[model samples]
Target: MNLGPLEIGLIILAVLLLFGYKKLPDASRSLGRSMRIFKGEMKGMKDDDVRGKEEATTVRGQLAPPAAASPTAGAPDYEAEALAAEARAAEARAAEARARADAARSGVTPADGTR
Candidate 1:
């Protein structure tokens, strides 16, 4: 399995004949450009992956430690907090409605309650 220099030359000649010298230059230029773009894209993807991992690590580090804020016997219930928020929102709406009705009865024109 030894291909001598002459055989290699013949192979090159055959390839040159199959694709003319003019076309070969254009093809080689396009191939080089394609390879360059592929290499650049791969580098960009690797950099993005590294950046993403670093960002994840930074976010993880920024978090409060588990021991610092563990649930205790006196912790407030989330459900109760949510219900309280809802109640406050309802009260605000009711207050607004009452104020609008009072303004309408008094025939007072506020900035936004013309309707």
Candidate 2:
């Protein structure tokens, strides 16, 4: 709840009577000074928070990310692998043909059926 004008006036009157007019000015001045100091401290903290956030963002920006590319970009193609496999198959067939020729020259006939 908030104090209405009546309550506030009563409080002021009480203070005035307790600490007469002579001391009231000094008391109010000190209170104002303290409030200003407190306000300044709060402002400083807010500025520090802003500065910290700015610095963090700058640091994050400095750390560059890897470049983006398509999934098939800068990658080996399977077509090349298929061609290499075909070449290997051809080499295997040639070797098998040479083996058969050597066996025929040595008289190893198919009718032998030797294990």
Question: What TM-score does candidate 1 reach?
Answer: 0.48
List the global CA lDDT of all models.
Answer: 0.61, 0.58
Q: Give each model a TM-score.
A: 0.48, 0.44
In model 1, where is the ten-residue run with the lowest total lDDT? 56-65
The clash count of every prediction, one per candidate, is 0, 0
Cα RMSD, model 2: 40.0
Which prediction has the highest lDDT against the true structure?
Answer: 1
The regions of model 1 sitting more than 4 angstroms off are 1-3, 60-115
Could you report the Cα RMSD, in angstroms, for every candidate shown?
24.4, 40.0
Model 2 misplacement above 4 A: 1-9, 60-115
Q: Candidate 2 on 1-115: residue-level lDDT in tens? A: 8999999999999988999999987777657655654565567558656755554334335622223534466754444544565566557646654554465446564343421
Per-residue lDDT value at 75 in model 2: 58
